[model samples]
Target chain A: MAEHTILVVEDDSTVRELLKYRLGKHYEVYTATNGKEALDQIEETIPDLIISDIMMPKMDGFALQSALQADKNTRVIPFIFLTARADEEARQQGERKGVDDYITKPFDMETLLSRVERLLERIDMFQNQLDAEIGRDFSNRLLPDHTPDIDGYELDFHSESRQQGGGDLFDWTETEKGTYFLTIGDVMGKGLRAKFYAFSFLSYVRGTLHTLLEESTSPAALMGELNDMLLNDDVLEDTFATFLLFHWDPHAHTVTYANAGHCRPVLMTPDGATVHEHSDLILGLEEDITFSEVSLDLDPGTALLSYTDGLTEQHTQEGGMLGEDGVRDLAVDAYDDASSIQALLDGVLSQSASDSFEDDLLVVWLKRLAE
Target chain B: MSFDAETASSETVIIHVGEALDFRNADDFKATFQEHVDEGVRQFILNFSDTEVLDSTGLGSIFSLYRAISPDDGKVAFADVSEPVQVVVQLTRTYKVFRQFPSVEAAREAFAE
Candidate 1:
């Protein structure tokens, strides 16, 4: 609460001086003889509040308020009127003009101060709420940060909502047993609710993955256990998350992953593409559902693509499918310039607008680097 | 927010608000009660037992009324504020601004004191 700017408009020299004297104690006060000068000062520095005399030389407060209302920029500014009439008509007229509050002539200092203080406080609270909404939006656009990089192992990520906020996430961590754990998942929906569920799912997986490291290093078994946990949990039952569990041998140049009803992970090479197709059922589908794993041998510069259904489900403006071909073409073109998994994944996603993503999408790409 | 005012005395006004106190419905509330404020009716009983929900803007509306009556050495008291409305009023720190009573008679009695 530094000195708040208050613009005061009054024609009478004595009354104007009194307003300046009293208001200066609590605010950086600006004085204007009439409406014309007041409007000019308003444009120069939009004050926190305005107090104007209803009857002034040349232009009156009502006319000034009308001018302020006519312009969209100044319409919402808080205003209070000072009037000597103290009649019913004058009160009604001020109320009709959307005056925040009014004081009669010969008003006490305390009366005027109380009205001004209350009005200023309300405006401050409203501004704070607007700022919170923006911060929440920004965080939403950069969520679940995980994607395999060009190094074949490190995580990388880029969000369409980086400015506003985006959801899809991928991450990799090594266990105490010296085995690596990799997971990729997408939460349902978008905006604040989607962002909330995405973080919840990520936290559950973090602990679940650590538990799996103690028992087995197999990707398929991890998927089975993860699905069962999700199905049995009450809060998570309503949330549908698609995930892939992976174990890699960096020295042997091999990767094994179990897919849980997620989109097939594509292997992108300069020569062509190879999709690590899904042969298993979706997790949390049923108690008896089984998951499967696919193994791939990597060549240097070969990029693996894993993503949410949002990529393939992108549609054209005329409602035709950007389809599998549009997505494939994007991957093929990107393979030339996108050296890393993060780069390739972002390239394909950037081709389609965020609003066009069919569902919450998360993609992880990893490429074997040159020796 | 609309009010039904009955002059309890030359100096006091009983303003009964019988609907939702909100931005969408505040006109009648203001019009009915503000007329009394303008007449310098120093004491008031703002009966909100009938209001369903009071949003932030609605609280500001009441704040205006409080500011109006308090300056003239008059006080505004709440008569029979509903439980849920009272919860919102308390949560928004507005309950501290108004005097509350369980019944209209209690509020009127307090206003007289």
Candidate 2:
């Protein structure tokens, strides 16, 4: 932790000096009598981290934390709150305010030191990842690590996050009943916060899916339960989301799907492509709303093009967008010759304004190989 | 890309919407309308003639606006909606909540009395 700077704000002269002395040995420790002093000191020399006391003479630690959060430059700095041990109120407030960590008032010196070191190290690690490996790290944490290898279908998927974070996510599981379920979901909103919410939403779906599938008879039935779950979640209740779910029955050789306010998917046959124009209201919008199911028997050489709005909403060079028709035409043209979603996307993006889309893109191509 | 509004009467405000209203611009769109709602403007007429698409997030924002003003007997309507936007509205069944008109003038007149 050499060369790392830390700001310690406490009104207690004894404890403040002690922390300065102990932490000074390993870091450049700055002292402040209160939150006001801390702000003044920070304006001169921004610290790499902050350890603050909630009780102060003037301008409490919570106020200090809010000030830092309001400033974009200091918001990323890791903050540790010093709270009275066993004070549930302080702990809950700290959690609500998104404090990095907590050091109870009676904390051991060694524990505080170790936590400081760990927090700084973690800050550095995430900084490195954010600078260079955001997309890679995002996928590693959120997306399915590997695509499933179903027996009869050759499935291909392409996913990319615009600006390193997106609301798009997908997961597939092979059930014990010998059926495969693949779903591509887009949570409402965008950017990093939405990215995290997408993870939580997907996590809940993945966790409850197996049991829900056992009880629910069809895709639409399962969708109702999913709707109930969304409405029940306090955080996700107001956020609208679109989900496209596809269930493949190997024995029946058919794919049944249910759409919840998602874009209509396109079916690429040997002759041409047709848009499956069916949908329901987006989730998190209404209660008691139901989704409808559509099933199609897949022949030997049929492929389904399912994607988020990122594909169709991409800006064309003409300053106009590539709307649904353009996307359908491009998918049809590409599926005629290319066999991979990557190739199909490459063709679609070739005419787009840039190779990188402004939104998260997820494309799931389920193709039945011609025997 | 942009959100603009003009008062048609003491109660109705017609907003000119442009391009796409997905996640990218949904917040801005809502924020603009929120300012009007805060200023006591209730009834809203959205001009969707130029909008190409409305994503879930964008639709959610509109729903939020609907919730914000509906308690005051305020209403929201779409005028000259493009086919694409119409499809999304119909698909979501939001058409039941908000009526559509052929032009901005028609929407404004419907709210007159």
Candidate 3:
């Protein structure tokens, strides 16, 4: 039925044929005489499950697994090892290598079949839960969480995920000194694997940035320090993000901010829409990259919308993306929509074709409402 | 989302990117370029004639290659950048670091070795 794909890699033709004969009924079966052959077969069809024999002619199952793990594309294919000698040491070696499951030489067909089915179910279930998790993270991280309840200011944020977890992250922290800091970042990547990378990056930011934020309120200076931290860190060596950090000074009615290669924010005033065009390089690029901390004093009846590219990159009915100018205009138009930023976001997002956005739409709207 | 590289010389390489360069293929893009870097190609010229989408992640990948080739005074340039890719380059101001040319032939001429 081609419902699923199963790859069987065994040096012995008899075992390979038996697996193909049985698993072929429920799945599209592919057989390889050895681990090297399995890899060659994998280039054509990526199977949902792989059953590999540890002992092979050219390459062993362990070596094949290490090869698969080396590649980002084939890293997560559910792998099982089959061996004749099922000793404790062998099991430990497989465990250390991240083998999903193992079957001994004298294994039951029903046991192997059930294990295969259950593992596939778990994989699918995890995929489904990822959607729900992203939704929860969107709600949990995006607004009203660490946001300060400052006087004379209205702040709101929201995210519409494409359900792909495109790594749009937002966080805010009010320090012990009452210095309010807000940050919006987008980790550069797409899809599930990137989601994990994004999650780690975001968590590290949430965990580590607060202490760093306490050391300096100058957004640009703090950004340089963050750059150094990222450059020196091992886990985030390959990761990159476009981050905008904002410091809202309620007493001065001003917002001081620094941009690390993020999209320009659209500002709405009585005159017209003004775009913040200045920005430094994105994070994790180079050492000693400096960002400028620019301060803007707010006026009554003013609104500023800072967002990731998702807002502007939405496709229109004409198959064109809404560019920077389009976003500025729409944001200005949305500013007059209603009293609520959520309504404004609803209005802005309604511009997309069929109300379906292709990426994660994230925005942090700051409004100085009219007196 | 995909890349093809042409060898102009042992020191220079021209990279052709198509349609999209976003988070989906940023790592692949970097890895692809790194292979050329390993092969002693220090100069890179990106041909983005067919590029329509260039996101922050894609820029980061380009930056990665830039960081790799920069220590030895290596260079990266853009030729025939599409409008969308132009938007990203302008916004990030990466053009300040990486130079641009009108065409791949021009880039090759600039790096003729």
Query: Which candidate model has the greater DockQ, 1 or 2?
Result: 2
DockQ of 1: 0.01
CAPRI-style class, candidate 2: acceptable
Q: Which ten residues in a row have the lowest lDDT in candidate 3 chain B?
A: B1-10
DockQ for each numbered candidate: 0.01, 0.38, 0.58
**For candidate 3, lDDT tens digit of each residue in A235-287?**
77767778888887767778899998889988888678989887888777777
Candidate 2, residues A1-371, lDDT tens digits: the string is 12799999999999999999999999999999999999999999999999999988889999999999999988988999986745788788888988999888788999999999999988888875674465455554567878777776777777877654457888887778888888788876756656767888888888878887776648787777788888778887566678888888866889898988787899988888898887776776556777889999889888898888788778888887777788788887777565668677877778888866776788888888777
For model 3, name the residue pairs that clash. Answer: B1-B20
- Least accurate stretch of 10 residues (summed lDDT) in model 2 chain A? A131-140
**Rank order by TM-score, top first?**
3, 2, 1
TM per candidate = 0.45, 0.68, 0.76
Give candidate 1 misplaced runs (Cα > 4 Å). A1-155, A162-167, A338-361, B1-113
Which stretches in model 2 have alpha-carbon errors above 4 Å?
A1-136, A336-338, A355-358, B1-25, B35-43, B49-57, B67-75, B82-97, B108-113
TM-score of chain B of each: 0.85, 0.95, 0.94
Which candidate leads in DockQ?
3
Q: Give the runs in model 3 whose Cα sits over 4 Å from its true position.
A: A1-7, A10-146, A192-199, A202-215
lDDT (0 to 1) per candidate: 0.68, 0.82, 0.80
Per-residue alpha-carbon lDDT of model 3 for B58-98, expressed as tens digits? 77788888878788889999999888888888877678788
